[model samples]
Target: MRKIILLLLLSAFISGCSSLSKSQIETVQQFGEVTSNFSAYPSAIMEELAEIRLKRGLYYASTLTDPMRHLDELDSIYSQKKYDYKVSEKIDVTFRVLDKYAQSLVLLSSGDYTANLQNNAAEFGVGMDSLVNLYNVKSNAEKLPAGIGEALGKIVGFSGDRYIKVKQSEKIKEYVTKADTLVLIMTSNLLEYLESSNLEELISYEEKMIRRNYLTYLQLTDTGTFESQREYLDLKSNLDAAKDLKALTIQSTKDLQAAHKELVQVVQKKQKLHSTIKELRVFYQQVAEIRETLNALKKDK
Candidate 1:
């Protein structure tokens, strides 16, 4: 009777150990999977965000040269209304994707946790509640700005196509500043997450995206064709500067701070470029209106 009891006890202990090991493995695997998926969300969002910013910057630059010219008419346009609408639509699409992704993550994590718990009935396990909280954090982060881009699209009206000369105007500058600030916020938020996760590969990817965005902005602002040596040189210089900054090693806190400072400078430059474009746009519109009036008077005569 004593030997039989000892054998039974040993079997139960072995089973408990096996159950615990399996449960731990499941938790780690689930955590890794979720975090990896979560990391991709910001990268996707940033790509769109960068494109919007660059487009807006180019539009502003073009408008600065000719106040009478409308953005839609420019070879490269910067109509807030159009951009905003597109951004809004994109936001809706992104939100839906995020919603589905979050839901799936929750279901998977819960299922895994539940199965593990059942297998180890004697021990308390990490609840699905914690995983739910993680999903909520990611979802909220992604959902907040989907509508703002759309709202901006509705406010700007059609101006016409002409090469607007760059002008220095306060109101135009203000709008540019506001738009650039929004972009900065988006980029900063993304960088913060990447930095926190210490994911070097993702950080490198983001840096490349940022550089591409800046290059697009430069291209839009340059009015002279590829044939214009001056314009080409200017564009090349800006591109090189942007690329150098992007490639710089940022391994320490100091490096990050320096990089941030540079980013601020870039935002300021974009604001200035936009301001110049806006002034030109307004000027071209005024000129075109005058010309139309003159032609109408001639016909009346």
Candidate 2:
């Protein structure tokens, strides 16, 4: 009878130790999904910018008096553009590493703790360092804070250690507290890059150039040819699509930041995530709209 009572007590303790509620698990899973999807936006946006530049160059080359004579200069331009895209790819990879870290949090909630998850977390830290180095070497903008990379690595690595030592509910609260800072840094840097860089400027400039290009042609030919008008409308449509996408991407980033903060509060304070989950849903819808815009642009191309 003493053995039976002891066994019952042990079972209750085990259950109590592992009591990550189903709702909490679902919340972490949704956070992982939304963040991972959002992380890919930078790469997609960079590709879209590259496409716009390529089209603008081709159209301008067609109008040149001697396009063949400037082939060497155009080649140089293409090479530089390719290099820019490479930098963007590194940025994309870094964001993905953060996404991976978020997934690790989900793993904790699901109680599927991996023995080697720390290695994956360490890799993400290394990726963050590499990203900062690439940006510092290639960009003239103010360098990112020197400690930001190391700090992210440490937080992520520590979170892995805590996951193994702590109960799921406690680990999540601690992880979210540390990870909220990383999320802020990443999302802020991305939004800053979009706002301060020439990418958005280029898109706006292209819109103006398109208007002028069509207007000039219309003036030269008293009757605006069907081919010219149709081409003008198509080019205008592309620019409008890009602008719309940029707006949505910026808003989505903002929503992502808010969602992460709310998640931290929900986890730490043991609050329901009704509004936090709703915000994530809105973010997902924005991401879907961004995808649809990109697909439409591709079809137009």
Maximum-lDDT candidate: 2
Model 2, residue pairs in steric clash? none
Off by over 4 Å in 2: 1-18, 65-70, 83-97, 106-166, 211-231, 269-276
Cα deviation of 282, candidate 2, in Å: 3.2
lDDT of each: 0.34, 0.63
Give a tens-digit lDDT track for model 1, residues 81-190: 34423433333333333333223223332332333432331111122222223433555454232322222122222221110101111112222233233333333444
Provide the lowest-lDDT 10-residue window in model 1.
160-169
Q: Judged by lDDT against the true structure, how good is candidate 2?
A: 0.63
**Top candidate (TM-score):** 2
* Tens-digit lDDT string for candidate 2 (1-301): 9999977886666555544455665787677765665666666666666665665554544444566755864786588579657645435545754666566555545544454554554455566566556655655555544433343244333333344434546556665666676677677767876676587677777777766655654555455668756766887787788778788888888887887887775665544444446766776788788888888988987
What TM-score fits each model?
Answer: 0.23, 0.70
